[model samples]
Target: MPCAPTLAHYWLAETLRLREALWGPLEDSGEVRRARAQGQGFGQKVLLRAQFLGQREKLDLLIARWTRGARLALLGMLAAAILAGAATAVGALGDGSRSVNVLLALTAMLGLNALAFLFWLLSFAVRSAGSGTWLGELWLWLTRKLARGPDAALAPRALVEVLSRNNALRWILGGISHGLWAAALLSMLLSLLAVLSARRYGFNWETTLLSADTFVSLTAFLGWLPSLLGFAIPPEAVVRASNGLQALPETAQALWSSWLIGCVATYGLLPRMLCLVLSLLMARRNLAAIGLDENLPGYAELRGRLAPPSEKAGIDGPDTPGFQAHFRPRAPAPHDQTQPLLAGIELAPDTPWPPAGLPAGVADLGIIDSRLERKNLLERFQRQPPGQLLMVCDAQQTPDRGTIALLAELAGLAGQAHIALHGQAGAGFSDARAAAWQERLAAAGFLPGQLHAGLAPALAWLAAGQPARPIAKDAHVQP
Candidate 1:
């Protein structure tokens, strides 16, 4: 039995629940529909619309839509196996040779199969975490192709990362590998039977280097395992009867054919059949392990959203009704009026460090670019965190998950956190880009629209010990 459908459905359900709890669901209302409609790619559409689905409902929808496609993929692989089987069977029925070289047949069938299996096992052993396998790459490509919607590309990276890490892909690919081998072997056996039916074939083994006794011992050793399972071991007389080019008598011939067929079924097909079953079992097991990593910066910070509702919930403008309620941050009272400090969060090397024009009493805490620097910054701040820390970054830089994670960590040490952004008016930085960064910052649990575009306001905001105002959407603020 294949486990893709079962595993994928389970994974989908888990993801749906986590996403809903963390990000909230998209209600099936005009607001979501309009947003989804306006979205440009499947990513955007999925994020917008999937917010509406209950855990079970999403699973049902996914299975109903993708199950047929999965079956079709399997069928296509089966068709390829049939072609390979026909080719192998044709090679088996060579005109002059009455039988295949038992060594050659073993090498071609079981040897090749064992080699491929070993490769997969080795890969499983040596592969790193968060790194994708070849099968996973293909699976991801297929997923993107199949799941393609106009807005799908706009889906959150966090969601994509979760989908990739799910064990369902591994299970599906494992099943496919086992199924491919089993189908090819079954078809090859059937083809061998068809050819053997049409001819009275004599079995003979020809070897230039080996003596007859060598083959007798080889045959006995090879048949030992199958013999334990009731498959007959050839008599020594029958094995030694393989005098080169002098064909074995009909009785010996029939026996050799039976031995060959038994080996193919037992050594070749049986192992693959067992593997296919095991893959399905493993697939089921993998399904149980497919849970979300809430520690990821994207999912980690969403915890605040799950907090109980409060009047402090910031309402979206009256025009957009059903938008997720955001909490409003009240300005800290201007009381503990100590001079603040400024630090850059991995600001670009070319950009000015410890940006000038702070109040005479203000201090330049330091720049934190590497993980070590962050650690040191934290330790030093543990003793004396800045009264109001100005966490600065370049507006020209993209706000990635790493940046958010770092900002979130740094925000924890500040008496009050005021985020500052510069370089908006510089070459390659646009107002739209700055706005996107603001949204990302907000999602990462930073003060919404608190990013500053100019050094003056950022410095002023830091000195004032209050949340900064939103960067102007229409014009870039000059530093």
Candidate 2:
């Protein structure tokens, strides 16, 4: 079997996808680009994206809360069942009454259970009956009530959807229903034993419409199954005599008591026990088959984004030694007192230029896409270094050696330098792509927390007029 963490991660991933369908899509944090670059499967990409956005942690907490609620609900149901069984037993056999109504006692013990079991069997023939059981639905309703919060509903909804998609919900719920009934029956049997042992009682039957002979035949018929299992059965004479107010002999009383106990055990408790076991086995088999349905709306939408058509490959140029740049560590420049500058390198044409709402006195170098543009920017910076420099790069493009080299030379001349990876206009950057840029720039001598996936945070850092704060690794700036 797979480990718990693996199963949990899968569940969280699927839950997030379902949430998107129900609520809306989450903010992009570059997970798609990274997953695409890594060539991960659809499910793996969803998991990767969820981790990048920090949804996994939130979803995990939700699952934990729901699990705790479910446990409490189960305990409450068990207590209720136990109490119900004890009451049934007590009511069926009165407190040392004149004579026990044998028929009444049998009906009280098994009537409802028998009716429910018959319905459970009939459910197999009905298509919609497998959706859920009454006890299971009650348990879920109680669990939801116990787990109160804004997102409490999401976890249970996702769980039901996943299970139902696999045709496993009915079996799982059936098992729970059967188990609860078994507990009730077992409780009834125990209560019966305790009451019968403490006091002496006589079992008899009385009726206005039925004759004494009919009662005798009914008693013998009911006792037949128990007799096969070594339980004592009263003789015809004892059954006929018990119809009157007079009590039977001690041996006859013992036989009647044995008959009642045997009937309850064989008819009520035994069937429930067997059904519980069968339901559990079926539930386990169905649960093992649970998996994400790829055809769902959320998953279907990601197919194009995460797994685009493959491009034909060809040699772009002859192989050559890799271009490696070495840099000497330079002392920190006093950029806090100088004006900050913002610029873009090889940004897509559709990307919004000179991003709106620039801070006062900040310089915008626009998009630098050519060698001449690069040369001019580097020389300009060398002559008059800005206090803070914000370099925005297109996250949609792969980070190559040339881009890394250009960023390195520019940073060496600035007072304080930071990089911002932006996606296409109106789109969000890929988290994996931003990480790739971070790693490449780190090797180029930029410090950690110097890379930003969103333009807003990078701009905020540029305008702060202080040393950069250590931004969260997975943080994304909203457009």
Candidate 3:
């Protein structure tokens, strides 16, 4: 039977739970708001939102709302099918030889295409309508109605903010896989039915019914021949061997019957496999988007229960009230409405991302010393915290210290600076100038929380009124 509604719902919920177990749910409220402010594109925003809410609630809301009266919709489909069949019959009755034949052939092809197009359009509209604010309300209502079972809370991704953000590539791949299996099996069965019908009509007179015996002995020997052969083999052996042999021919027949199945199975699997690969790629991309990878090593670093990078290097702000909330749509545009917060960024058509480069002495440890020559400039900024120094540097254009170099001057000013980097920028800049400075630093090889890592210790030393080591150059520092 076709999948029952309840079964489909459970399957969707289970799949979402699996995703959450592997990648965490999207961060819904603050992160999305920050992402929007930072000039993330619409697709990015949608994906971020999906990560936050997890796709289950989104899928449920979408299917429940849009697929309402699905039974009624099926009735419409059946009616269309009946009308199609009648049209074919009427045309055939009128002139089966020429005009009716052409008309029937065209209708068979074009009418099916039209029907498919209509169904797809309708489904897309329904899914779209179930998105944004409407979905949020529906989700809230469902959450209240369905008691909080242990399985209800899926682990969320820190990046995603809504169901729309779930990897579309993965979904498409899975659908293609299923479609292939179904179509292949259906065609095989249909071919078998046609073959059986042809067989029943009787084979060509020249073909034998069964036996190829050339015995010249009398009828008495023929009657004994059947019993002798039957007794020679066990009943089960004959049946099993015959069944296996039959299956081989049937399979061969099915394979030979249609090249369409072969082409589809081969070509269709490509998109499905591609989708699977994209799902993994997207997971890594989404993680990078939120600055999580900076705190860890590679993308694989997020797997275990290791302590998170650091308070400064993480995505969350100090506010706990914003946790666990899902995304909602922006309000309708108003007369004389203000431009979007990120208007100056010019995110689309042309992205304004800055080059990924660090300012000198942003951290005063051996890390920078390992990358550039510091000269004697480290001593001048050791007297004050980085916070005080940067605030002062923000105002002044020059300082008469050891060197007039940009690195030395800035290093002196930001000795003990503490800042929160939220929002997503369409461009890149110095770590401090980027959306999440500390996270970006970690990602770029400055281990902010690793005690053995020299960068954090140097920044700490600078904060504690101590001089920084001289800078050096290293190939590892570049992204």
Model 1: lDDT of residue 126: 76
As for TM-score, the candidate ahead, 1 or 3, is 1
Model 2 residue pairs with clashes? 30-430, 30-431, 31-431
Please write out the lDDT profile of model 2 over residues 68-167, one tens digit for every residue: 8898899899899999998999889989866888888999889998988887787887877353366877887788788777767877777777677666
From the highest TM-score down, the ranking of the candidates is: 2, 1, 3
Q: Tally clashing residue pairs in candidate 2.
A: 3
What TM-score does prediction 1 earn? 0.51
Can you rank all candidates by lDDT, best first? 2, 1, 3
lDDT assessment of candidate 3: 0.30
As a TM-score, model 2 comes out at 0.64
lDDT score of residue 383 within candidate 1: 50
Candidate 1 whole-model C-alpha lDDT, 0 to 1: 0.60
Best of the two (1, 2) by TM-score: 2
219-265, model 1: which lDDT tens digit per residue?
88888877777767779987777664565777776667677777878
Candidate 3 residue runs with Cα over 4 Å from true position: 1-59, 69-75, 95-307, 310-479
